[model samples]
Target: MNWRMTRYTYWMVLAVLSFGPEAAGATWHVDDSNTSAPWTGADWDNPFQYLQDALDAATAGDTIKVAQGTYHPDDATQNHTEGDRSETFLMQSGVVIQGGYIGYDNESPPPDTRDWELY
Candidate 1:
């Protein structure tokens, strides 16, 4: 009922609306089951066991280390598009997904393949 309180509330709403989708970080990682067959973990070494899970948990700028696989929607990925490449992982706002091999699923991992980096 107070005008002062209404003014404050209006400012708060304005603040949140000022920033667009690029305001905060929001990244999605698809490293677990690339094609829904299960992470090869060949080059990954220590596979996370849940690619979609990781992606779901990731926010902006988080990089999902996709080793090698086909992450289809059947595996819980509903945001995939035709632009998505087989090897290239989806990068979102500030997201920096990395991969060992993009095409060659059987390619050997790097000697010091630690993991993908995020923003």
Candidate 2:
């Protein structure tokens, strides 16, 4: 290819690599306090009850948005070793974890209603 074409292609490749696969991923919702059935964590209206459920349903580049609540790694049916730090709630590579949700029912919660808390 010509120099200009080669440069353009190089830049395109760089952009793709920099963004990675997660750039176009979807957002998943998790609310342990939610009583929604058939928990799929697909949307805020029907969120999974456990963080691990959302994580299991998520893929690389996807974001897991969790509601405010205490989450125990074991509560999600995750196998945990007492002292295995590496296995403790280890998130998928490239996945993003966001928390602090007011979890309003029936209607979508406003952005301002969302709050952050440490688990």
Candidate 3:
């Protein structure tokens, strides 16, 4: 392999090994169905109503699990104009945001199932 490619691979492996589950932080949840739910985002049943809420609460090494739903950028922020395209979801380094979850099925205990092909 080329020198640059070898070095890149080495660094990638090292990074993965160095930052393992020990570096992992909390896992936040966001479900659109939980509009009136608490802002905790602690679990599937009590998830943040908006994706923006999870983003705001997340720190480095944190993971945000989002349920299947249509989320608009303008829905969270009221300061910006209704149709303003400038408003966007700013991502953070080391913070993983994942979607495709079937959250809170109204069972005794909510279920957190992730199947992207469910649609």
Candidate 4:
């Protein structure tokens, strides 16, 4: 293959691999401090309380949007528990986990501000 042909083939392969079967899907929300019940995790209005819950409900191409707060894997309730809590979070491939949401409400023209902290 010529130099140009090789370069074109390489880019085509890369594009196919990157945007192949894994495409952007639904977006789920998680607010650990949210006291509301009947969590659906569909949107910010009805967000899940725990990050794990969101992850569990997410698919390969889904995106999980987490609100600003400290989360502990050992705490199923997503509350602040004192002790040496150690747990692993199993993430699925092609799933995106984004944080730094200021509130549960999805405001139009979202404020250019975020407050995310991990403990």
Candidate 5:
């Protein structure tokens, strides 16, 4: 192949790699205090009320940011059908669920700041 063609191919590969699915992961928010129903879980203000909701929507390479609160699988609205006590949160491969985030507050917009000790 010509040097120019080889260089063009390398740039094309780099562009694809930079914008691939693995490089374009999504971030989902989960907050127990969210009174708003039918939230998209796309941002902190309008977050998924249930942890399971975010989990259900998350795919590979996605990140689920959960607020600091108690979340039980039995209270799941999406994953658990019968609200069985034996139900549990299923951890997906390549998906990171990070907790200790201060979710929506009536006073101010929730911060992206995360501190496990001081939520």
Candidate 6:
């Protein structure tokens, strides 16, 4: 309504647009190691490499497209520890992961300890 309020709203809008979908911080990409032009490249073209990279750089609302490979955590722990857990792959507050999502149990090598969550 007022010029001040309008200006604040404008700035807020700009911020949201620039940073993106609020908690949008997920990264998507294949995690295979065999889809490169040279083939000799170090997973350069392999979706797996890119996928892993994205996961590493993801924040929130991001989605990682895992091709077809084993996704094992470093610790193999059964805990999300949301909020600020490094290896948790929280996918932020509003992130989504695509591809290779075999659910909580399918994620691991069966007999899962119940660690991942699929929203």
Give the whole-model CA lDDT for all candidates, comma-separated.
0.48, 0.72, 0.77, 0.73, 0.82, 0.44
Question: Over the full model, what C-alpha lDDT does candidate 3 score relative to the true structure?
Answer: 0.77
Q: Write the per-residue lDDT of candidate 5 for residues 1-119, one digit (tens) a residue.
A: 69999999999999999987746799999988887676889998789988888888899989999887888876666547655778887767888999988886634434577878977
* List of clashing residue pairs for candidate 4: none
> Cα deviation of 33 in candidate 1 (Å)?
6.4
lDDT of 3 by residue, 18-109 (tens): 98777559999887888674668899878887777788888998999988788767556324355667778766778998888887645633
For model 4, give the RMSD to the true fold: 7.2
The digit string of per-residue lDDT tens for model 4 on 7-99 reads 999999998899767445999988776777868888777888877778778888898888877776654545335354567665678789988
Q: Per-residue CA lDDT of candidate 1, range 16-102, in tens?
A: 988757544443333443344444333344344445445555666565566445554334334544444453443346555566533
Instruction: Give the distance in Å from residue 6's predicted Cα in candidate 3 to where it truly belongs.
Output: 41
Candidate 2 lDDT, tens digit per residue, 1-119? 59999999999999999988644798888877787586777777778887877777788889888877777665664455434445556578879988777663535455225667522
Q: Which candidate order results from sorting by TM-score in descending order?
A: 5, 3, 2, 4, 6, 1
TM-score of 5: 0.75
| Weakest ten-residue segment in model 3 by summed lDDT | 74-83
Candidates ranked, most accurate by lDDT first: 5, 3, 4, 2, 1, 6
Best by lDDT: 5
Candidate 5 segments exceeding 4 Å error = 1-22, 79-83, 106-109
lDDT of model 2 at position 37: 85
* Candidate 6 off by > 4 Å: 1-27, 34-53, 75-91, 101-119
Q: Report the lDDT of model 4 for residue 6.
A: 95
Model 5 per-residue lDDT at 98 = 94
Better of 2 and 3 by TM-score: 3
Question: TM-score, each model?
Answer: 0.34, 0.63, 0.70, 0.62, 0.75, 0.35
By TM-score, the best candidate is 5
* Regions of candidate 2 where Cα sits further than 4 Å from its true position: 1-23, 77-87, 104-112, 117-119
